[model samples]
Target chain A: MGHGGGGALSGELTRHLFTPAYGNETLGGLGDSAVLPLPGARLAFSTDSFVVRPLFFPGGSIGDLAVNGTVNDLAMSGARAAYLSCAFILEEGVGLPVVGRIADAIGAAAAAAGVVIATGDTKVVEAGHGDGVYVNTSGIGLVPDGVDIRPQRAVPGDVVIVSGPIGLHGIAIMSVREGLEFGVEVESDTAPLGSLVEAMLAVTRDVHVLRDPTRGGLGTALNEIAAASGTGVALVERHVPVPEAVAGACGFLGLDPLYVANEGRLVAFVPRTEADAVLAAMRAHPLGTGAAVIGECVAEHPGMVVSRTGLGGTRVIDLPLGEQLPRIC
Target chain B: MGHGGGGALSGELTRHLFTPAYGNETLGGLGDSAVLPLPGARLAFSTDSFVVRPLFFPGGSIGDLAVNGTVNDLAMSGARAAYLSCAFILEEGVGLPVVGRIADAIGAAAAAAGVVIATGDTKVVEAGHGDGVYVNTSGIGLVPDGVDIRPQRAVPGDVVIVSGPIGLHGIAIMSVREGLEFGVEVESDTAPLGSLVEAMLAVTRDVHVLRDPTRGGLGTALNEIAAASGTGVALVERHVPVPEAVAGACGFLGLDPLYVANEGRLVAFVPRTEADAVLAAMRAHPLGTGAAVIGECVAEHPGMVVSRTGLGGTRVIDLPLGEQLPRIC
Candidate 1:
């Protein structure tokens, strides 16, 4: 039977997978929409779709990843996240228990982030018609006054900062999908960055650009900011943080850590004078304990991102023209 | 290649299947989101997903079907729709041209409704992984002040009115899927209802409940309204408009038109004293030219819906407990 059928199969998916992962006070009631109290501030809205393969990977499952991913995107926009709308596409034959765990994780993630799930939708596809599950979430948050940040706002001479380490999410997913094992566990860097973002925003309003190094990783994000702002970026290899396990995994797989994905970390571009204050604020947050100034914007080579290598060579970091790891979210 | 790749395969589907059926200005560009001007009112928002099978059917294609379906949902909320976001899931090996026509139809329908397509997403699945295409659309509309209406607001003595005939969309899809078309064409009555809704809101602010008879048809919508408002509904079969072709098809297929679906029609609940005025206003609109008084609310049988047949027999109309036609949106 198709997963969309309103029968035992569909019930299992909803009960086990969706409900547990995304369960919240409003979601527990299972109404058409989640009613939320409006807070005082301008709202910031964003939506993203996740199709990461190997539903359950080291350090996290798709359910938690979905929640954290959307939360982080909103955080980058300097918004205090409020509510989320979840829509799911499930394939027939997906075990109900797995779905339940995913739903549970989603619920846990939302709870940790202090946000509510307000509205949701579910659809089932034929077994062969879809991947195991695809989750699309749309979230809205309140953007406090005087916090204006956008990718295009990165300016020449601004200091670039990254919160904590990168590449754990990409490598963690790859390890599971490829059935490889490392002596030390490498979990996904999946966690809500709302608190850290809030801390940073509270410390300074001069944050010009904020982005999570997802799909294309730190390199791609830098390239995008540079292109969008019509400026160049220069990164110091030593300053950028990379967990040892993630770096080892990348090296073994012939992957560049710079091109890998990270869910919990974010890059911020701030005026040179405010960089230290922003870094200090980030370091105070548990998720951003390793925060450091990793790069600086440059007027030369507009729309380019160049990294100073550890061995004294400079390499231009460009966007991947095609999909690197399909279904890596 | 997932359908949401925003790449070649996705472009092909948009050109073939979506274009001819629902083409419109904002949809034509196929951008990230649709952008529309606020039409002098606060916004009303609604979203729906269509998983109807046999994507192409008599009278309409899923392309136009998806556009009008969502547009009508927004209209039912008494909003002057301004924008729509379309998301697609394509089964690999589905012909590209078919998808393109669907995209075109979406664009056309938005143009006809004076709405814009501000954002879109596409994902592709392996062959047999999906039924041909599933479209999810979210729409936003501007609602004028003093036009508060909801299903829970219906009261006893309120008159029930329907904009035009019922069951066209259901029969249209059924005829195609079952290959049992009637001699006369039974076209899916799929169309945008923003103009009709605007016309009604222009006449009176006393309208109480507005709903579209889509998936479970007129009976299901009425039952929902009755239950939501804690009131009973008495619908007269003779007063309900069912096109001859649709009626004949339903009889032949042993299907109840009351449980079928409609695309372009709506059911409005208004004060009995002002029923005539609301019907007159609805009739003035092009989409509601065939509008008629269908029934009235009653204090008896709270939360129940009963239909008085032409022969004087009455039967309870309730929500379908299970899928009548899988993937019928």
Candidate 2:
């Protein structure tokens, strides 16, 4: 029932409604981004609309999420993000200062990500017709040669490396969220991951799958990769990194940290032989300081994810039925 | 007042706010589309978010406007549009059948425009958080060789040609709009103009400026050109083609047809000697059957627009402070 959940409902909507309408070769790839072949190069394109309730949150605002979210999608395709287009739908009664702040945030984020906002559009709706502001950003990036990253490329004997701690982004939003905040404020881990991805690719081009654990967090991202490759993912519970604050928040809220959304974390599926090099590369980066090898693709339970718990028990991390929290991104 | 009017308010917002934020070489062109250059060719990039209320009017729905609007923006740069990205913000509780109908319209419109919907995104808002649906489309197009179309290229003695009748789109939306219907029904001229642009380009490459008279209509579009080129546009009232139905509706509504929106029309600035051939080319296209030479750029009264009325008196046509009709696109 949660269409915004980025879980089964979102997947079903795509398969049943969107795919039937606009399905084509490029979209059929169904990667984080669509890889388009240009005359001399391949261009990766992706789009995302942020509808977060509280425009301003602890770590970042909707502006930061708007820019980094699309940048990460493009990066997941092993592309260096180049250009972006942003469109804003604003409610008439929202203050100009708020719009100005958001604009400043976008400009700042794009500058940091090394991508230019090349084109943009703006529209205003009557007071009650829209939230204060909702932003949509679509980006284009250049995929370097020798990079053949894709979810379907993941195979048995591949090591799974998570770039950093999970659930911070969603928990950060929830902390400042109206009627949902906990005692302590948590900052969103919303940072651009393009440079981090480039660092990983520099180590080796054998990286099979690169995913940003975003909307449905690590669990949803891994489930998608597993299904796409027709391979099973075996995650070690104790090895997955989770910040103390995020864990505490999820524990208090009776939520699984795995399903909480994140803004600036990535998961990599690399060849077993190249795991150490890629992990080293990721750890050296500032955004990837918390990198950990949490899991690996296995021959068992193809198209599923099973976690080996510290208690000597195993549990299947299935795709979430609906969104645990809506608009966390 | 009329944030969607695309007139003075829109212009000021771009000049004072957006320009300072994201303006660059490509965006500074400030045409209907921004022309981007790749290695081997020039690409036109444009974005527009359709917040047109009622979603559906007499002749077309938001889906048609979403595709055709971006396609026309690309064609304005003499580019053959190739790819498009569609993003929809739908309010929860909106029926799937309604979404299905909108999708069909989008597919039909894109097919008609000869552009592919390469990528798209959908975000759901809580029922009251958004209107039924709002669509945003950003397009990329390739400009052919020898085409250097821009508003600044409009020189004195360049004849201004209207591709078809004006005011139909706005009047049509208003006619059936709640509490505003007239005695008769009028249809929105919401059609793609890419093929028509191709036909005109086939006739001559010397055409200077191509602009689709949309939200703010003919007067505002001409004012923009005049200001961009530091020239004045002189319009002949009798020569400017306005369909009888639209004229009659505007007369009863006490609205100037000059300022009403048109969706399926374009105004061009071409050398006087090449005007007839261009007009003929426009007429040969179904979308441009009502093509007519409405005016010419003049050196006098630079950066302003004046009309030569049927009564032989000259009257200045200023850009409206706000829109006369909102969401008429």
Candidate 3:
């Protein structure tokens, strides 16, 4: 009954979760590893693991979530993700139907992002020895010439941008985890951002930093960038976009939306001169329709991040010393 | 308290299970990952995960087992391994010292193999959601040119050689898991084979199939080669040199050593004309001091593996239908 058996359980999980999120023509039906064609461009590779609980939640399941998560990570690096490797850890007694649903979602997500799932592995654990399922994905992409973006490249006065509203994914998962159902549905913000990043990159290659607000969310992500780049970041609370439903959910849970995760959104810092052009391009993309300029890099208070409150007060945002929601992707 | 926390518990496990069996300078320090210099050859990369339970047993602990396991996998390609990436999945509340011992053992194995640990990741899981710990290691090695060793290269009449004994790892894990300890020490044959592989490659570029029999044992590995190369394999069981302790352990457990796991050994298929030279080179290496010729490839019975038993009877060794011993690294 273990996930690694290659029997009914394993087949069901793959058929539902993996195939749906990552299916592609050339993936050779998902073997040990995807044999990929190396393009001429320089390669950028990244891997991530998702251990989110409540496999099925508002707006998404772990299947689509895993695919979009890796795709976006590749996008943040301004790379065209070409292939992916998926490894699954499944717990005994997980329903076959649920696994199939997840795989279908993976296939759909991969098709939507124009990426392929080339290689994969499946391992199953006894009921008490594993969570429902944990997914790890490693992706390889092509970074085009004339494009150079890194956190260290951020400079003073550079504008910071958020691709869309934050905290939706985290709040959505929390609601499901706590069995809190709202009258109005609060969906997760889980979607691939490759096109949005492509559009932004097309406008200007001056984008210095691109990060998804996952785990510790926007607050922690910006703080990391500040620390890594040895620069300070200042943000206007009023300028940061948060969906009303997400705000209400966070308020009820006594959680800071800024500390909540977002799967479909990205935070980008671009040169001051090209900020407007990049914002315009971001706005044109479907995934970045609500994109906005949130803040600017500052020379003062190096390695610090501060935000101006609506009532004229400012507060320092620090990196989280611990996980806010463990296993929430 | 997850096994991968990089905290006290993880540290303890590394020290106990890993350091004693495979201690060395480069691995003794136990960093995030191993760092080894490439020294001017194209790197061959591979990775594997160990989820074996009953942490310590006759053959080895998961710590030293995983370290040498990945090193041998890379060595199978005739590459000089340089670095390793160790990632852990620790269950909550696992003892700190247990984790440390595992880390220490990893360090020792890396040192003995002359590799370095350059990077690592640790994650903790809630109790009852995971086993003790699962270790995944990725290794990079430098492969010189004109060394095109692959399973597909096994030709008709190529001699199959096994460097040292086999199945010690699998039987050791099984014995501990079942609480059937042998009277005598039945250690897992866990050690890095990089030097032995280097010696064989030094003698000839005609080495075709290089494999380490880990999961599903020697039978499965050879079957994989047969299928990949569209050939057949014939094994002389009388000629295979399994230790008395291993044979006794397998007999008591009603298990076949040929189907048991081995962490520190390898099987090489080479041209008959060059077999002696390769064997001599293997014998000179400390790890392969017990090297022996156990099998050969043939054109007939394509994609099959047959063994000549001690009674001189021929028997087909089919690929294992299901896992004989789950979590045997």
Candidate 4:
């Protein structure tokens, strides 16, 4: 039931299944979005389907995730999301009021992100054959000239910087799914990151790579970057930003914080020369208040990620074999 | 369970729920696709989710429909689809070979349609919580300059031409679902209509309105045009092309052929002056060999559709309340 988790199985499905079936250079890139050239401009295209259970969650709902998820994908490509196409799959017996609430939330989220819902579709499945609501949003964004960002751009001299704290979104959904709430409520950090990406680009278009650490969290994203660029990543564990509440929840749940998901946060790889200036720019943005540099790309142990422990020892951070939490946005 | 049947219920959902929730003119248009003005180009964007039961139908599977449906939507907007983003929701325990077959079909269909499947996503749901597979495809196409086609452009004296036969797709699905046979197997007429649309445009750019009669077939599509343009439509029942097998099946099944779905055919409203040439152009295309002039827009009895009976009497054709065959496409 968990075949699509963002891990080794997912990687095998893509490599041996989807990529070969597509048989094209575009899909082979396997980036968050695909960049297509038009008459006088470049367009970034991306698609994501949200199937999170319990339609409503802490600080966000499926509606909010549906919009922000695609918007953030475009942002990671250094594009300004301009339009979104939404499709909803509803169970037959679901109430109209519930659908209305979701539609309103999607609309509000699009407005907040400054993107228009250009087109949409709806299909209803028989009552027992489907879940309450599943949303698939595909976005089109304009990629400005000279702004080239991809996982392959990470180089040995580049420094890795995460926009803010991690693991809140994964933990938040787990808390609701398992009915285990900590003393402090951990709200999902689900906010649009387009403006923050724009601020970083404003500082310089030389941002090597930008990725929203979703699904398998910062650890998987880093491993992907390392494998795609044929470089190793070295991280200082103490420098990684983790909220006190999130850390406590992860510890109690016997989960590693690095493998938890974050919706609004991003990991950026910038040249060492532009790291300080870019960090300043990210800090100035509202969504990047906790911006921190916790890692750097290295030439040793290619396609690997290792973190320095507090005891002056280093341990390899393996990419998760499957998701710690399934059905996450 | 049949809420999205492309009938009155679907219309109400869009008008009362979706449009108001979106609160944008782009979505309010409610056309098959939305046209957005890009720098130096007009982009047509559309989305559709295919949840047809028994993934593999008689002539085509959900994979072909997923590609061609969105391609046809963009074609209706006077655009040739250039790119598509596909997302799949698979139920847990589904066989990999089955998924592989669907993927290969999608790739082949996109290649045949001359559009690239640029990006995609896949998610898995628990075994009993979902159907076998649900596919959502969002497409982007570039609209040619000086060609503007929309539902509202169906003015008085516009001649309506249908590309080919109808009702085959719906009957084919019904036969499989209900295990009924009428001595003849009805194969679905699923094919990409982008090239056919291009051929029609080559004859003239004055095609006023274009729609693929999918879920609610020709009756509902004609009604939507009449309502959107505030014009009446008059049709000759004898002129509407229906295959002999499809007619027999519909009769035995107690269904109206006018309300049965078709996947490949399109109904085009063109200026009276250019109607003959456009019909000739359409007939020359492989997919539109059975093209016929079925009706014309009239100024009298606005927002209504009436057809001349084969028995020399006139009858009003009411829009269906819901699909006679759910998940036909």
In order, candidate lDDTs are 0.71, 0.87, 0.72, 0.92
Where is model 4 more than 4 Å wrong at Cα?
none
Over the stretch A1-329, how does candidate 4's per-residue lDDT look in tens digits? 44677877788887898778777898877889999988989999999999998899998999999999999999999999999998999998999999999999999999999999999988988877778999999999999889999999999989999999999999899999899879988889998899999999999999999999999999999999998999899999899999998999999999999989999999999999999999999998999989999999999989899999999999999988878888988
lDDT by residue for model 3 over A112-214, one digit each (tens)? Answer: 8887664344455667888877766655566767776666667899999999889989888998898887667778889998888899888987688888877
User: Which ten residues in a row are the worst by lDDT in model 1 chain A?
Assistant: A29-38
Query: Candidate 2's residue-wise lDDT over B1-329, tens digit each?
Result: 35556889888877777667764566677888877766666777788888886888888999999999999999999998888888878888888888888887888888888887777777888877888888888888789899999899998999999998899889988877755656667788988888898999899999999999998899999999999999989999899888888888888889999999988899999999999999999889999889999999999999999999999999999989889887665
Q: Rank the candidates by TM-score, best first.
A: 4, 2, 1, 3
Best candidate per TM-score, number? 4
The predicted structure with the larger TM-score, 2 or 4, is 4
Q: Candidate 2: which stretches are off by over 4 Å? A: A179-184, B179-184
Could you give me the TM-score of model 4 versus the true structure?
A: 0.99
lDDT of 4 by residue, B1-329 (tens): 55789899998998899888878889978899999988989999999999997789899999999999999999999999999999989899889998999999999999999999999998988887678889999999999999999999999999999999989889888988889887888888989999999999999988999999999999999999999999999999899999998999999989999999999999999999999999999989999999999999999889999999999999999999988988876
DockQ scores of the candidates: 0.08, 0.57, 0.07, 0.82
True contacts kept of each: 0.06, 0.42, 0.07, 0.76
Docking class of 4: high
Runs with alpha carbons beyond 4 Å of true place in candidate 3: A1-45, A95-101, A114-118, A142-148, B1-47, B56-60, B77-85, B95-97, B104-121, B139-148
TM-score (C-alpha, index-matched) for candidate 3? 0.81
CA shift of A123, model 2, Å = 1.1
TM-score quality measure for candidate 1: 0.82
> Which candidate model has the greater TM-score, 1 or 2?
2
lDDT, model 4, position B16: 93
TM-score of chain B of each: 0.85, 0.97, 0.85, 0.99
Which candidate should be chosen as best, given DockQ against the real structure?
Answer: 4
Worst 10 residues of 4 chain B by lDDT: B1-10
